[model samples]
Structures are given as C-alpha cells and as structure tokens.
Target: MNKVELVYRELLFQALEKNNFLLTQKELSNLLSMSLSTVNLSLKPLRRMNAIKVNPMNLKTINPRKVLLYWASVRNLNKDIAYQTRVDVSISEIEKNIPANCIFGAYSAYKFRFKEVPADYSEVYVYADSLDEIKKRFPSKSGQPNLFVILKDVNMGRYGKITSLAQTFVDIWNLGEWYSSDFIKALEMRINGILE
Candidate 1:
C-alpha cells in the first residue's frame, strides 16, 4: 500500500528467491544497507499482513530470527512449482555436502558460481544461511533451484551447473570492464595469488 512497504516486499522476495531457504534479519539488514532497527520495524507491518512468516518466534543475539516469508506473486502456486522452493533446497544441500560455504565476496565470484540473475548485491556475493537445514533437504530436494551437482544422488540440478565454456560466457557477461573497478582488481589479485 505504501512506498516503503513496497520496498520491503521487494527486498524480502529477493531474499526468498536468492538464499535458497531462510534469511535472517541480520543478512537482510546488511544486504539492504539499512539499519537492523529499521529492518525490524518495517517488517512488523509485513508480518501483520501475513506477507511474511517468522519461524520459531524466538530471538537471540547471533541468529535471532528466521524469516520464511513468501512473495505475493506466487502465493497461489503449489509449493513445488514456485521458483524460490528450489533455491531453498539447492543452497542448503550444496553446503551440507561441502560442509562449509563458498567465499562469495564479489560479483565475479558469484557469477563464476551461480548464473547472473537480475539482482544487485553490494558486497559478499554468496553465502549459505543454514548448513544443517539444506543438508537435510538435499536428499529429497527436487525443486526449482536446481543445485546442479550430484543431481542424481541428491536433490540438485535445479538450473544446473554451467559447462566450462558456458562458465566462460557467463563470467565474461557478468564482468564487463571489471578491470575498471579497483575492487574487482583487488579481488582478482587475491584469488589469483591463491591459485599461484
């Protein structure tokens, strides 16, 4: 109804689709570049309207809340048919197998991993929210996210992994004149040093 509400909805939907499952208020705060208080305050109305769902209904210092919010656009669709469902499982399962998270510190890192979506993140390209949850889902995860690896053995291959040539294409596509960004160069230097 209000402009601010619309923005919150957009951000929440992005998180739902991006994170594969649950995103904490802290992550949302960082990603949106908004204060935690502001994020929490704004979420009140969204929660009241049933636009979002908070799991556990408990709070803590490090991992206070888990938002299981859904986007309005696909509320009527079956859970299996929704795009966000796949991501929820894919990310968790992947992390479970890896038993750790990837360092998605920048756009290049994310592009090198996940294909480019029309989302914009300022820092830390990709990370997992829950290792245990997704790992549990991995075995039966046959949703839209398409984890890509170990598809036959587990719940994967939502969008699927890009081939090496395809990776080159997506990498180049996401990184146009990355040389111009001092940040990109710094990151490349760091990663390259590790390789060498």
Candidate 2:
C-alpha cells in the first residue's frame, strides 16, 4: 500500500480498533514513517467526506462508517496481491500453516474477530512480506487461487495477529466472492455493536 492508504489504515485502526479519536498529523507521520504532507493529503478525502473533524491539536472521526466505506470503495485490493495460487488444502489447513509473520485477513480475520462464521469460506487472504517464500510453500495450479498473499506494509501489525476490523472489512468487501456479502453483513453487525 502507498503512504496515503497507510495513513487511512492508521487512522481507521486508531479510531475503530484502539478507541482513539484524538490524533495529530505529526503523530501519524511519526507512526507511519510518512511525511506530514502525505498524511495531510490523505486526510483531505476524510475531511471532504465529513468523516473527521480537524482541530488544531488533533483530528477526530465523526462518522467512522463513512470513513470505512470510503476506504473500502477506493482500496485497490487487486494491486496489493503479491501472490495468488491455488492450494488444494482446506482453508483451515492454510490458516494453520501460514507463515508466522503473515497476518490473517478477510474470511480468516472475520473468523478470528467474531469466533465463528455464517458459512464456510473457500479462500484465505494473508499479508506477508515474503512472497517468494509463500510461493515456495504453496505452489500454483491452473484454477483460481484459494490463497491470496497480499503485500505487507510496515504499519500492518499495529493491532496484532489479526488485521484491524476496518482493514478486514475493506479486504473482504473487495474480494467480490459469493460469500463476501454474508461476511459484510456479519461485519456490519459486529461494527455496530462495537460503535454502540
């Protein structure tokens, strides 16, 4: 992901996952290792969307749903896919065998977040730094990939093993799989529960 997307991810993680709405550009820049200009540029969209209220000292997310939806709508999920290869193993097997540094996302994230799923998922999404290692571990075939390894960013593991809720929601939404809507619905309900 680019610096702009990293900024968004950081902001979303702070607000939704960390329960922190007070954030400064300087703090974001330092945390994300991005320039202040880039962080400001990324916030412009959130400002325009009225998703956040910018104050002299800090910015606060006024409408997290708007911010979440905006990021989800614009996130280039395909571009982040560093490796895609069909694996014959079950989703559980993939989940159990993922690299230690790799973070589970999408369906795997939903399962981790909520402890259950409405339906079985066929694909496993993960963020990993070593694409070659993943490729070596899971060789590709002719069919659609059952495993998608997304390129990992430096700021990805702030929330720990699972992807942040906002990140997971956006990734699953971008998947466009038959089961995505179900996951979305479940995620929305979970988000609402949290926001309340």
**Predicted candidate 2 versus true structure: per-residue lDDT over 1-196, tens digit per residue:** 6788787788888878888978899999999988999989999999998999999998888888988899888988998888888888888998998888899999999898789997789999999978877877888776978999888888887778889899999998898889899999999998898789
Model 1's number of clashes is 12
Residue 107 lDDT in model 2? Answer: 94
Kindly give the stretch of ten consecutive residues in candidate 2 with the minimal lDDT sum. 1-10
List TM-scores for all candidates, in order.
Answer: 0.25, 0.96
* Candidate 2 TM-score, C-alpha based: 0.96
Q: Please give the CA lDDT of all the candidate structures.
A: 0.36, 0.88
Tens-digit lDDT string for candidate 1 (137-196):
444445434332211111112223321221122222343343325433443443344324
Instruction: Provide the clashing-pair count of each candidate structure.
Output: 12, 0
